[model samples]
Target: MRESILKRVAVSRNVLTMLVALWLMLTMNLPFWRSVWQGVGGMSNDSPLFLLSLPLFVWIWLYVLLSLLAWGRLTKPVLGGLVLVSAGASYFMNCYGIVIDYNMLTNMLQTDVAEATELLNGRLLLWLLLLGVLPALLISRMPTRPLTWRRELAGKLGSMAVLLGVFAVLVMSQYQPYASLIRNHREVRLMLVPSNVVGAVHGYLKRELAAPAVLEVVGADAHRISAVSTQHRPRVTLLVVGETARAANFSLNGYARPTNPELAKRDVINYPQASSCGTATAVSVPCMFQDLGRADYKDSMAGNREGMLDVLQRAGVDVLWRDNNSGCKGACDRVPNEDVSHLNLAQFCADGECHDEALLHNLQAYLDGLTRDTVVVLHMKGSHGPAYYKRYPAAFERFTPVCKEVQLDRCDTASIVNAYDNSLLYTDHVLAATIDLLRSNAARLDTAMLYMSDHGESLGEHGMYLHGVPYAMAPSEQTHVPMVLWFSDGMQRSSGISADCLRQQAGQPVSQDNLFHSVIGLMGVRTSVYQPQLDIFRGCMPATVAQQVERSELRVD
Candidate 1:
């Protein structure tokens, strides 16, 4: 009886460990498997052998890494934690089509509870239970094999070395094919299960904690130029930093739908060719307000440096940031900022979320208290999704049969687009209403509104649901953002910038790089850090008598 019991216990321990290992290998990599399966058709055209062998190699690589990291007695607990994280990562990647990288993980850490709750749903809970909780429970309950520390360490090292040798041999044998595959499909590397997660977390921590304490400040000598008040009207310019609005959907940008009907009716210059500095708000918002262009802009640099708002404030320009989404991602930390997202506005707010129009509440009263050279930034919650239907008021539900659920995959492609477009329609209404608010104060204030989204969103295009894919691999849907400029007649006269000249330059290729200088130019803030070459409006403004004549001819009567 004793012998039989000992054998049964040994069998049970082996079986449990095997099960745990298998679970980790499969559950942590569902997204990767899905990607490979989907790309099978395309794989035949490229390197079929490499594609076929890639999965096995990845599985072995992951198994070896996990085994080496979590061996003997400590295996169960460590593996449990990894199981949860990997499962969660896989679920997000599979559902939202997001790549989990250092920047993305950093963004995840910074996400407020309110924002994180928006992504929670039955589908997510189900995935967590099946993949994370189930595996974790099994891992915790499993009895690990007892071995001497020396033996366990030796086994782990030997196993790791063997795995490394195998991997190296495989790479060497299929060097050309594997190299080509990886080079062409760089995104494939991002889907490497728990390895990607491990690397990303480590990278995030190192950057977050080990960076230099002091940062270089740009535009320290920023002062408003005398050209700011030629007509003596307070140069009040409202920069509406929109969220997740793409140029492809804007009516003014020649979309089939009249999404921008209200803005289109106004004398707004729609720059269809405008691009974003970064693919995510966390990166784009700060980069847009920085003197550094996209090529030079780094998250670490942006975090430590004085931004456009800082420079503007230093230059004696009254800078106020009114936020409706995620607290301006720390861009408005130094300046006077307001969080109107929680206001109990009966018209546009519900269920802890307010529409973009909520931003305009008490605006006239707020503007009344501003300085003569004021720049009020309305950071809008425009078109933020996967709950696109929730972004707009019920009246603005022009696109019917919208995707009401957060689980985007549950909805059809058409429904998703409909919901997104409805949000854009509401955004249009809010922007027009903003213009009207500026128009109300047009007599006293030289109002001009610059509306540009921080980053574009992906709506079920190429099996991708939301934005925040790496910038290099990101599609135009995630990069080509809509930028519209509406200048009041007072603004045109005071700034001596012809409306026609600005309109003629609307089609030019511009980006978030132009924002810092263009605003400085518009407000007439004379900053040494301001780059004229980066400003979109610099070349467009009238320079000579001949140019002024051409500008007048191109001006709308």
Candidate 2:
């Protein structure tokens, strides 16, 4: 009796799929339509014909595309996934002001469970329940005509031909304006729902499914060289990988706020103009550790072979990675790495997550025991948002009326910035503490700390809330990162790096591109891959010291 009733209410397969697509297009894509409305010169009598026809033309194309895919038994599952993914993309886009693109999608995929959990707030749940789960369930429950593959294929092809003709007519109606909008605002393409998701997945798969690349080792012939090499004293350096820390927020970089009160007092060399290789951790972390700048970097490249860490390790440097953020993004695959969050230290950790200061646990002991040219990579959970309030402890919450809520959209811009700044305060504390630790051990070892953020964050800037917009359209807030260098007296004298010269070069443009070669130059690692010109410290080092940093080919053997 139930089957009979379901059959009576059942629609043809194409009808059900097209209806679901229409429902998703109408409801699940508010952000995409808003971008479209703004793009078409919203609410003005400006080119009334083209403005009106453009959105409809886009609609027709989306409908045609979705409908064509909804032909058979696969329709319900595919449409359901589209509905859920579109809802997810919509929630992020509409609430956080992020666009779904290949990089953003890759970022999402790479996010750890702890990181993903923070994003699961009431509003996101509501979005998923109202728009994603309910609709996906409805799509699944809706009865469709039984599949007759051969006949269905024939009917779909015939219907597709007619749809294409109508689509062609719509396109020709406003060809110039449509072409202009598309060409001028290419970012609009990334704002579209489901299509944007589809295109991102396609782009990801295209790279992922390609022929397997044989691992190519980088900096294989690396060997250390220093004018003042010590058999007893070791070069102890801290490579601090900051998370989502923008240069504009750091007072050391001349932000209006005194967020870096501790760092300011420390007399660190602050590079105000240092930008990131990418706007997200997934891309930036690995790219910064490689010779490849943003232009040539790919996520796959990180996994293809050894990176800077391996090179440093190969050159008899005691390399260690301590993580409070997500794992080292494959940069520490071959290094002795441990996660602070896993230790769950009582004061510094909570709920399987740790404060940035947790990374410093037992660090003095580690340095106390270090006997070789040592490098420790501290991956910090610095200022990663919308859960900015959670990054620091109560003492670090110097900013009042801060947004305690994880869902950032609920808070005012001031609250968001306040919470964000507090996290930076804590980061400042962490860096200062690390520097202090390094300074304490300076007598035993040539100690220095080099802190560079993987990427920057957007805090309600130009309607963008978080980072990971497609790089081409990302603003300075998402790309401009903070880089700080603090070397103890021993390191400064031993390495021949003048603080005055470093301060002068700090104002000049520096980037993560310099990181790969800069570390090489700093440790006096001689390698074919080391380019002295790419090292920021090269100018600060004496010509005699800098001359030794040149690529082996450029050197007189």
Candidate 3:
């Protein structure tokens, strides 16, 4: 065995790298090639020459890139790293049908240990073992032919120039058709192995490691509209920011399943047409809190600006963020916040991550002790896959044959849906419990609760199993999120916004863009940044109530 292993074939570095690139094209880029095949008429087109040459064009492009990195001393190490990254990226892209982009990279970077552990299942292990580790081991054993320094440099450049010239000729042969193909199917390029991941890393490092932006305080001039009025009691509002809860699976949003049985009976006003700011937590959570709407949102600029939390806190509302998901993605950086992950709570602990119950555990006591107006933001790990079974307790698994595995693609489609729906059932219980707590406190404090998911998820839809697809190419399963609102009788009277009025306007479109302005108006905050047109609550307000709010605003002036 040792003699056989030592008898490895010897090749020059450029020749070895070319073979490695070819291996990558065959093993780790089926999805990329598949996209190309589907786009160019898939072998049925009459022009066999154009169809065949187009793929060679891409192969030469990749070969030229790999050749640049195949240099002395670091060639094997860099190539080994490339194998590992491509194996992992291809495994996910092929299995989950997800595209690697800047935002997806941000999710991977921000993902905690528990979330990362959930992905270490049998399929991924088999893939890494067969493709990543074995290739790396063989790369380590390969013997390179000896050459003088001058000869090596000259040969490398000469070979690279020839390949570049060939690549250029191929592109110019079918320039317009190839250009149109790329323009029509943008996701095809994003599916490329290793290169997509490399580009994403470059973008992430460029943005995150840049000089930190200076924080600019906004809505400093904000004040309560009825600060001087003594008629109403102090308000208590609960904003539950949910994770990966798609609208298509929620019973409140017309899902065929009874996922929201508890919430369905609570008379909550469900926004059927609600959408998210982004397709991942890292982007959606921050964008949800910032005043800038999704279209106007830029991460670099968002870091420097104060969000709605700052504006609400400036208006004298006692703001606190309780996170049961990953830390607020910088949305709660300025406010008082606590992480509820890995809590020792006996009823809702598993897989090194706690359930949504952690956010609600002893939450009433905190609300009961509120001396003044308060806003508590509960960040829930609702239906966050591919560990949907772990998001809820066993009793909530009303759907039989539920998928308990983390690798959602391995499970059948029915089992996957059952597991995800079970999570929604548990979330419904949490939300209903919150409403009950607010109802119990209705005598002294007028209370309300608003639950909006940061983004949605895809469960075996169009061969996709998880979230974080690019927004432009994302399916409705990843962008259409559930938005639920419940107000107590006291809150309705005090805020002059009733459940009936909310139900009437529930059919209108609502999104995270309206969250900032809606909350500002809901809390009776008078600020320069408040846009009444974007406030969903304002449009639903009665004419008499509008007049009353207008008079109350007159007092602020």
Candidate 4:
């Protein structure tokens, strides 16, 4: 009986392997193969995460190939069921990748994957193909054995229970705090799974989960401001929201570049002393746009606040948002938002995927047709790191010896800096082009552009590769960012502003908190909350002595 059971177990293993192979051949999509290929070659010409997990990539393909041929000898029904289940699981994972627009195959193109290639002569794609052979060999050598009905029944029951449990946990964990790791780190699913699964269970049991709250406008309202406006037609204010731009590296703020050459040429207001309220888009974006400053972001449900969009819309300003970043995270849910990511010129080289330039294409179109006083928000995928090489075109490869690998720490600081600078170079082009557009339109109406980043990044500084660190200990490079306001001649006249005075005050400290009210104030809106005392337009007369000091400290130059 013991010998018979041993033979039967061996047969089961071979059958399982064969089934997985057949299923992959049938269910794996073209994108999957393309990703596998890109993963091995350090080419982000397509996806993002390909290089980060190159080693494990081949193993997945190998598992599939080997499971198909020799494994078919196992009892037909049981093997067929397992194949179907595994196929579904793998397909689901791939779909999740698409939802987040993260492709593991190209993840390392910006940092260390290419450098490592020189040392290992091994391609992740090639290795993955080789790995597939191992399972094929295993199944071919195993002897076929008779199946036991009772054993088969037990296995099916166990698999069903596990699948149901996984599904239930995923649903229950959605609104809870512990599962934030899953929501935020979906790209690193394999590494994150076991712990996330454990966290999910705990998250399900925790009953105190808080539902997201709707914020209310209070204290300072912009509605009355527009109704009682002073001497001007409202300004056409365009706030360009930047993603993942760090202050330490910007040449305009003194990082050693001609990156800000264009902005410096114009009579722009450079708020070199500005800081982001949070470290990640998930936190900082909503916090910055809403009435809640960094201090009050945690309990955002008090309903004592309003977002920048709400305030502008309330004042009867025509508001529109063009997003090139990952979906708006509900920040622009209340406004007219357009996904112009596909129009990005870079997409031609980016394998049809979009980036920052996509937002710029339709921008002039949107500006040209607006009949009313308008406020447009442009969100850019600016300097979002870990894959900087893929963000720009080869023409901007001026900073060479740039790291093309994703493991940023493995490369020298100079190489990492080079890659980042290249991305910044492209940003410079986008900004210059945008300025030119606004300048041309300013002749017809008052126009201004305000650009601010969500948060900064850490590139191997103290051994961190990305942003999202807690705020209190975040490095200056991660919080201090380049903030600038570019005003047209018409805007200056309408707002009754002098370029020389604004430039003199440009280096002063300004928090994004002032932005919500400043927009309304600049547009000549007269809400009770529109505090000119906090407005940069007020020039040197800050609301409080402490705010004045804070602004002064920010002006290091």
- Judging by TM-score, tell me the better candidate of 1 and 3: 3
- Which ten-residue region of model 3 has the weakest summed lDDT? 223-232
Q: What is the Cα-based TM-score of model 4?
A: 0.61
Of candidate 1, the 10-residue stretch with the lowest lDDT total is 548-557
Q: Give the candidate order by descending TM-score.
A: 2, 3, 1, 4
The models' CA-based lDDT, in order, is 0.80, 0.83, 0.85, 0.58
* Candidate 3 wrong stretches, greater than 4 Å: 1-8, 227-232, 301-303, 542-557
Give the clash count for each candidate.
Answer: 0, 0, 0, 30
Give TM per candidate.
0.92, 0.95, 0.94, 0.61
**Model 2 lDDT tens row, 355-433:** 9998899988887887678889999999988899999999988888899777677889999999999999999999999
- Among these predicted structures, which one has the highest lDDT? 3
Write one digit per residue (lDDT tens) for candidate 4, span 104-130.
211212223322243232333333334
lDDT of 1 by residue, 441-480 (tens): 8778888999999999999888888888889999999999
lDDT (10s digit) by residue, model 3, range 136-173: 98987798877887888888889889988988887788
Residue 87, model 2, lDDT: 88
